[model samples]
Target: MVHGRKFISVLTLTVLVLGPGAWAGTETGMKGALADIPADVMGFVCVPSAKALDEKVNKLMQQLGLAQFMPTSLLTLVKEQTGVGDALDEAGSLALIVYEPASPSPDELHNAAVILLPTANAAQLLESLKAGEETDGVRPLSFFGRDQFAFSKGGHVYIGASKATLKKVAASEKDITSRLDPASLGHLQTLDLAVWVDAQKLVKLVKPFIDQLQEMAKAQAQGSGAGSFTAIQLRSMTRSINMLTEGLESAQIGVSLTPKGLGVSFLMATRAGTKMCELVEASPSTDKSLMVGLPADKFIVAGGQIMQAEATKESITDLDALFEAEELKQHCDVQQLGTIRDSIREMLLALRGASFSISALPESPEGLVGLTVVSKVVDGQKWMDNLAKVVAACKKVTQKEEVAKALELVKHEAGAATVEGTKVDRLSFDLAAFTEMEEKEVEEMKKVLGSDGVSVRLAAASPEHVVITFGGGEARMAEVLKLVKAGGSPLGEDAGIKKVSSSLPGKRYSEVYFAGDRLVALLSSIGKVTGNELPIRMAEVNAPVALVSSSQGPCCQVDVFVPMEMVVAIKDTVMQLMGAMMGGAKQTQDDTL
Candidate 1:
């Protein structure tokens, strides 16, 4: 068997054999009954027996005066247990023989009552069953003050007020109801269950308003802005009504439908706790109105202590026009500022009440007799300027240093003057200084280039032109030319040069050429050359060529093949140029010789 089952079997055996009073009524009975419960079942057992009893009583109370409360039905459902039957039989016999109040004395009745009280075994059985064990034939007993009574196979458990206690409760309830408005009391009576039935519901009702005010507070914290005190006042009123409802004895419910929206409040009071809940929904017609006061002891319970709570909500809408009216603006003026401050203080007291901690400013300022004013006014860029104008006007009217100091403090505390109006602060890498340094370096390079004979000129050249220049004389420019050739070539080789020419000519020039993939020609000559390698300084006016018949063919050979037509035409042009030059040269030569 499981450990839990084994333990339970052992406990049951011990309890059945042991007599009454062997275990303490509270501790030992609970330990013995719950020792064998599994971890998950322990939750049911660990819950206080009184709490379970209270829940059972509540359930039975709901069934009161209904068809389910019939005596035979109640007996079959709630009281047909072996242990309960035995206890009732014993009590009934004693009542008939010894506690016949009509014939017996009061002392006999008292003795009979004492004997009818729950025995140790009965109490233990009841406690164990209440710890989550199922019971059969449990029923409400009308004789036991009309509260709930249950019977199990093991024993019986009862929950109810005594006759005298019930009378006192009824009387107290009557007293409280008498003071309330008759309409309100009637409205409260219509509720089906107690107001404190669900604490979460009450929290839901008030949370939205609190959340709205808190948002406004956070915005106010960021900077000077218009705050929704009107919203705060409305929420405070709702909280008060909710607290009042939660603390009522009759489980009364009240609902109000104003132009602003619906307001629902519930009140419930019990021996353990009292609670009130009020929920409000804003309507279309709410104006620039404020609820001014609330009760000090709003949510006090039976133990004279306040409950801990968190009240916040997520679905509240904004009341823009209500907080932004011109009349509200007038209320914030300098002359009326004191009234606003006092109103705020009163509103705070109403909302927080005496149940919470509240600190207040002293009645008078110490060491400084200055007027201090606090208000949430308009939000705009010009707010500070307007405030400064007001301070200047006040300074002009008053000569007191305290007034100036007070204005200064307001300006400082408000943090209005320190913020830039339009400019936003931002961080960026500083490239401006780097750019200035670059410009200076470029200027130095220009000066150095001017002093050197070497000139650097940028140009655009085609691939063929660049290759030709690289192969001819500008081999120093091959690096860039080779890169372009490599990029464009399919097979990746330097092709031979085809043509090379310079734009400028007639200057003293040197030739350093390469041919057939090697240096071959490097001569600089002014005279013309013949096919036979004969230097022709000057050609004859009428030149003859010898003719010879060779096996190959009849050939006319000359040191150079100068056509007769080209020689005659050249001689005539040369004689013309010489005749003009001879006249000028002889004239100069005759004078010199």
Candidate 2:
């Protein structure tokens, strides 16, 4: 039986996956259940077997060293709520199929969704219904907060919004399961949970909602000229929304738990020959070498390829129009702004990829955080030229009192420096220069950073790339440029990083790598300083965390991989915290006595 809470959860999952499975195996009635699904469904949610999933989760919990903290059995709760017996044990799979209107009616939509439950004993299941009456071969019942129809046939029980829906599914002779991708089905067969959707059909079903949104936007812009900045921006956004919906062909999501780790993957495929598909096709793969020149000990490293030229150019034109608008034109110099815009466009057009690295977090609020950013460009000279223009334009605006103060600080605190034959721009400042703080607090910050001033540097890493350095000073800048000159392998080529990356899809538009071991250590140190030690003491594990987004054929895939060691640490930490809380409560009771 489908309860309201559970039904709503299924529906929520369907939507979350939009932007974004086990049976107790056996020949179990899965085949018959699939055969009864309506062929023209807008979408369907499938659970291979609730019992199988429960077993797999319990086993995984045990594998992660969480057996002592296992929760109550899921099936027991289901039986308590539905008043169904062993009949559920024989139920191999559950499916809820969403369909278009059966027939248009003036009163309300005739649209419906049907739930198919495969059970060998239909009589036992029927007896558990709270209130129902037989009508023809179907039973009319109140389920999921509404009047619904239910019937049993061919080792399965079908329930839906109306008898018409039940009839279509029960009479389905076309193998509806054939519509799904074979790969998705194969994955579902082995995973604990999964969902697949016919994206095109879903778009048709949700078109009314999209249309309403567009109408609302038009209403908001009622009196504005079509050529107005707000109106043009609105139109552009609407086009993007339509393209996203119309371009998608299919989508599937899967969740799995194993000794390696727990994994959730979402894949979305665009229709062939669509503009969205073309955009993805034009995206370049992430260059792993972009990680070079970044310090090897950074806690986080992230990089991605830039969008195609057409999109960038369109964005620049929109900015120009925005600056020219009457409302904005009165604020500042339009001509200088145009120069800044052109320089920006030049820089963006030459960019291929960029990467950023955070070496360390500040120990205190006043402490300086250290980091570096590098951009791979086709023409480094153009990047440098544009950067100078931007600086000059910014200087012109400093005539204002507040602006002049900031400009003076920049000129006083930073300037050009020679590091290993390369002219690098460096900036160094103390918290006192920017904010009012107690002298002792300022001293503490300086002590933590090992200097009275925090510094950053900028330099051309190569003929094709430029680099920016923060906090590490000349030594760090020299080291970074040395790596560029050496053309050495990036830290990602290390064994730990390679292991994590290899587990994810290889053709990525973007990727992020995390040093979990260093992160945990940092957190532990922070906890000790704050006098809040964690209950469970964990040793640093050698696994790295990775998130990668890539394209496989027409499908867009985003995968996040967290190593099993991290999972174990998290589980142990949670269990220990609960135990400590319980112990504290007992101690409090004794004290009251």
TM-score of each: 0.18, 0.78
TM-score for candidate 2, please give it. 0.78
Write candidate 2's Cα lDDT for 119-190 as tens digits.
Answer: 777877776654377886688765544566788877567776667767777677665567655534443454
Worst 10 residues of 1 by lDDT: 549-558
Error of 1 at 579 (Å): 99
- Provide the lDDT at 513 for model 2: 71
Scored against the true structure, residue 130 in model 2 reaches a CA lDDT of 48
- Top lDDT: which candidate number? 2
* Clashes by residue pair, model 2: 21-192, 21-193
